[model samples]
Target chain A: MTDLPRPSAPPVSAPTPGGSNLDVLKHQFQQIWQVLAALALIYMVFFVLSEPFRSFDTLLSIFGQAAILAILACGTTVVLISGGLDLSVGSIFAVVGVIVGIVLAEYRLPVPVAVLIGLAAGALMGALNGTIQVLTKVPAFIVTLGGLTAYKGIAEILASGRDLSRFPENFQVLGSGYLVPMGIMFGVALLTGLFLTKTRLGNHAFAIGGNEEVARLSGVNVRKSRIYYYMIGGVLAATAAILEVSKLNFAMPARGQSYELFAIAAVVIGGTSLFGGRGGVGKTLIGMLIMQTIIVGLSYLGVGTSVQRIAIGIIIILAVYWDVWRRPAR
Target chain B: MTQADTATPLLRARGITKHYGAVVALDAVDLDLHAGEVLGVVGDNGAGKSTLIKALTGAISKTAGTVEMDGKDIQITTPTEAKAAGIETVYQDLALVNELSITKNMYLGREIVRDTLFGHLFGTLDFAKMDTEIRALFQKLDIRITDIYREAEAFSGGQRQAVALAKTVMFGKRIAILDEPTAALGVRESKMAMDLVRSLKDHGLSVIMITHNMQHVMNYCDRVMVLRLGRLAAVRDVADVDGDTLVGLITGAAEDKVA
Candidate 1:
């Protein structure tokens, strides 16, 4: 603060919404802290409110799988931040799981190679979505919607109506059996968090979603950035697939079914602006935790999954509404 | 290459033209801008005013034209090139990522990389350097942004524009072209924007402003260029043309004798 650069010229005033104003940028740490505080308060309220109705330990336990949600949310957040959506994430997750299982079980590939293949497959699929959409100027909705169907088909083909299980002991490590998966999940989250907050790529991702035209004008290599975003998203979904396979120890085509929705929900709950130009992977992590806790706790109480689905729907809607309310009018 | 006039016109466009399919959007326009001058461009809708500026800034490519900076003809085929040539454009919408802090937006494309030895997952991001530089730039602009790192979406409209202007200047441009910088602004805000425009001249950069408000042309401009029907009507000294005469030129009531 003391080494502030002196004004070379007289100060130019900021333009106000209603008048010529110098739109003040208040402290960011303060704003983020408030958001984090609100998030904590909401969680406390959610726990306290739900306590009379359920067990808290169950919620914590189910949250372990919320890592899947967190991963998907990470992908979804990238798409959303880039001013688009990726309904294909769920399908991509499914496809990647099936492919990994096939390459490892039938083709007898090395575990490390399988991981690479699965991740690469996911990235390629995502790149396809981005390329076709940007190249054709098609709305991402349509493009990804097509991807949703196409990828699901690929998953079905790979699984061939049989859940591909009986993998190497190492593969078993990812599921509920070992702590490595948990560690990896946290590691992935940390990496993602750093990618979104610390890297130049992450900064560009946020910038593109905030104002794409402005991003392009600023020389952000918009097309390349979009492609990069989707690639990151693809890798996350595939990684989530590996984690899911480890937990379930099954490469069922349907294993990752509906995963994209969960990820989107987590991202929204984490406080990412659906409108783009706002959000971070860290927020998505919070969102995933919230979801995992809800699913686990509610299930332990034997609340039907239908009810959980309804709860998820409500959570998504309310989360978006909250975001809508807090957001400044564009 | 048209040699840059030693007097150093901040920007010069010779025989600039752009055509879209069968239509001619901009046709053979020549513009000269001098350093430390606020050149006002007034034109009716579809008069190619925006097109000309867009061509200069590389927001759009001209079908034909030579752009000169500092006495040499150069190709400005992209926004990056235009910026590198010391030309900047800030659109009316302000074109800022409101989710970004002023400092972040100011250095959106050009980020200072930090040493990675201590840098974490995203790389060695030097938030400290960014924060310090951003705060300094904001202070210099008298921008009252309290935090240099908050998202831009939280700011008001005028504040967004300020961020945009700061972005252009921070990038180090010699010519700044603003499109309808004050269109949606209130009287006070518009006056403040004009003040910034005037300040650009003091900073030794030429300014080209596109505005619908004739009052601004009369008040803030050193010279006014009026356009009609996709062509130049007249380039008049501010001292000579009244608001009425300028409007007449815009509406084609008067013709430019030079053309």
Candidate 2:
């Protein structure tokens, strides 16, 4: 039987007059120009106000400190874009750190094995969060909010109220230098960006967030895809936790406390929508850098920690306001 | 255009029923969609119009029914299964992600990836290929948009409708189901949308459209099916029925003459 030809593969014709190379560049710049301008303006303000902030070393250290948050925020960016939240990420980080500490300090496992186990634990916790939310049809906010407290308790129980320290020399090297954590941050960011833009699941995340019922009608497995997003968030949280523990050579149950909020703040500051379906890891990187710059710069100017917190709080509000204000009325 | 095909319909649904507890939404509704023809489904509010379409397209499960394609029984309990059975639905909401580019929304669930190791392992989308093909499709369909890379939110309601229609044309094989394709558009936009609906037949695909617009039914549909109070009321060639008769059939003022 001769079947009708499917238009699945249309003949490739000449490129359209619009969307030229320059147009593409212009469009790309349009998406990021506002955030980029904000970052530059903030940096310049800091550079001019504080003499110490003008130095290259201070800038390197600011990025070095921002690296951990950047890694954690990458996962947050994915989760937010998928229209879900994982408030337990901070606890997930602490739990993974404690797991790594136990595996190395108490169990005498190899670094690679312990690292794998920690990562797995992180994924497992994330899976638990995602699975519980899916099965119960509970809002992710309530589920992860409960997990925020519960997972922290679990981590504390695992640590027995003591901080684990003094890791092997090679393990300490993983986070000791500026390059290693920064490299991991960029690598995770690159991977996260690719996952969002390149892969089918990544695209589904955006669709699901933008309008879940529509995504479902379009044959997207909303439940399954959401779980995968939470898993990515979980694994990245673990990555950040391990790096922090290695750098500090200590793992306390209190580690990564309130880091989830910081990650979210950074993601929002980077122009990612808290409501989801609109943001990228690249914007998130800039957001993280902007945040770190403000914190570090304020300290250089002899501003107290309380004042620094106020500054971050104000920035977060402004960022979200800017997002809402600029958005065309639907 | 009103001449019925005596040959087998491309898609047929029998005894499609749905119940919400004591409420009977659709009751034993039957439909036949012939090849290369537009079938308009019309009903008043709560007259089982959307429910019948939902049952046929597997958006909602039927209480009792069977759907057939090409004279063969097919099981479709979900939208994915419906699409797999050569049925695509353009939902009332259009289902376009506001933040994504037109090309991205066009290939949301079924994205084309690079045929490389990266594609195999990581499922990296080949945007260049997608861009090229979508442009070709728009050109072929005579739909013009300056940039396919613009987000869906940036487009007007009519443009988004066009994108949704284009998507159905792209992936829909034998049958395309549209749920209120122009319910949201202005007068001019609605005309454009109906024009696209008419064009769906030119592409050699059968269409089942759900609409309340009498003008659309008169202009676009080859045949019209009326649903009233959870049951199939009448099926008429658009050539035979006036707009008043369709409204009467929907409101139960006039009995189904053919029945």
Candidate 3:
């Protein structure tokens, strides 16, 4: 007994429960400074290299171009944070776009009704993915991979070898000006951020991602919450599809190909864990901007698409490597 | 300690049986807990100690059983139902989410949301209120954790144990169940855990603790229950049992004298 060490108090220098607001702000800045630094550095490099990249319009256009991907990434961020994946979001985007096109062009329905139908279809597809995964006890990676293929087929069948176009002028307004889409992107980001930080479902998402067994023991409704996360993912994908179709005035069955992987890459680049349990919508937003900046900046510098793709691939690997490197040893 | 026998047990379980396929994990075990008494449950590996606790806590379904609080039968089919009945369990794994802050882990399933419309609509957690309450709880219990906002992963083993025990104290209104609370702790931390158990008893909560350590049973528990091969082998007042005798009972070397 005498040889046993005594219990000691935590160090006095440790932060207290009543830490001041300044300390909190400082801690937040510490958490995100790396991403902010990277964004600034990339913007500076582009601004220095290309004359066209210096214009305010280039910045606005970057935001506009980022809108669709940003919207898709928001859903992926939530799903990834919950320790799940949805490879079918790209397909969901195409399916929803085709559905909206048919409703407006062929059926001549109101824009709001078409939009509602598209959103509902997307949510239903997402729910189906979650239900199958949960019920069959299949891994989400496999379940959504199957969804990716199946939903694409469904979209093609719905489109019937014809492009749906010629929407009412009001519908086109959603994607016409840079301000509208940009505003929509920011609005989606803000809402998603609030959902992650403020809601019970958001907190539960982190808990479930951190440890599914622990969350279950803590009385979290794991199955229902998981289904809800996938639903949100689906709805966001649908929203992006609707915006894209409005901008293009045509819905192609091939639309949104590979967007799922792109959105996931952007989320991973933003520092969201690919393994789940730690991330935010704000981080995803920054990640989306980083990718958009590189794509637009490279094109302005007369770089080819193949080069841009290679650069993005390298950045994704580096971002993931950084995540792994910074993780404290188990 | 003598009063424990005569005062109707705070919690009682009868004929608790659990079967998984062809294996009988728990063979109609019985348990009794008195108010303000620490009851230690001991058994060898695969001896149904955890099975019994899970059955009681509704972590696992029982093949057959009845659990009563103050002699009134209560329905417990899920962990939430068990919690609603004022029964809290600190599982062997501690069940703490490492990435979440102490405040979040403390109120993981049952958070205190704000009174505003946003809270009502979105179920917005009131972090300020939760922080204040948990801070006050730690102070009242004399637990030494200062940063309640730090993630659970950042804490030492003993500190995490403290957080888990504090959670039990906060919500275990009538009964607190702990499974191997000190298995991962050092000698000093083991003593600290026992001290916290004493505090829980002092706070007038009945406790059902499972441990492999004979010293803890002798030092802290008023009475001990031993399970052997999924069956309740013996129950003895700690004063009447020595460490060797208890080990014999656990290993099937000694006769079941008290039964």
Q: Each candidate's iRMS in angstroms?
A: 11.2, 11.3, 6.5
**lDDT tens per residue, model 3, A203-282:** 99999998887888889999999999999999999999999999999998899999999999999999998988888888
Q: Where does model 1 sit among the CAPRI classes?
A: acceptable
Q: Tens digit of lDDT per residue, candidate 2, span A1-330?
A: 111112331211222336666776787789898999999999999999989899999989888999998999999999999999999999999999999999988888999999999999989999899999999999999999999999999999999956488889889988987989998889999989989987999988888888787788888899999999999999999999999999999998888999999999999999998888889999999999999999999999999999999999999999999889987555
- Taken over the whole model, the C-alpha lDDT of each candidate is 0.75, 0.87, 0.88
Report lDDT (Cα) of residue A212, candidate 3: 85
Worst 10 residues of 3 chain B by lDDT: B1-10
- In model 1, which regions exceed 4 Å deviation? A1-59, A161-163, B1-10, B19-24, B115-124, B213-215, B254-259
* lDDT (10s digit) by residue, model 1, range A149-226: 899998888678564888888777766633565567678878777777777888888888877887888778888878
For candidate 2, write residues B1-259 as lDDT tens digits: 3357578888888999999999999999889999988999998889998888888878888899888888999999999998888888887764587778889889887889899997878888899999999989998877777578877776666777888999999998888899898875767668878888887888778999999899999989989999989999999999999988888788887755432
Best model per DockQ: 3
Number of colliding residue pairs in each model: 21, 0, 0
> What's the CA error at residue B212 for candidate 1, in Å?
3.6
Evaluating just chain A, the predictions reach TM-scores of 0.85, 0.93, 0.95
Better of 1 and 3 by lDDT: 3
Off by over 4 Å in 2: A1-17, A161-163, B1-6, B255-259
Ranking by TM-score: 2, 3, 1
Looking only at chain A, give the TM-score of model 3 against the true structure.
0.95
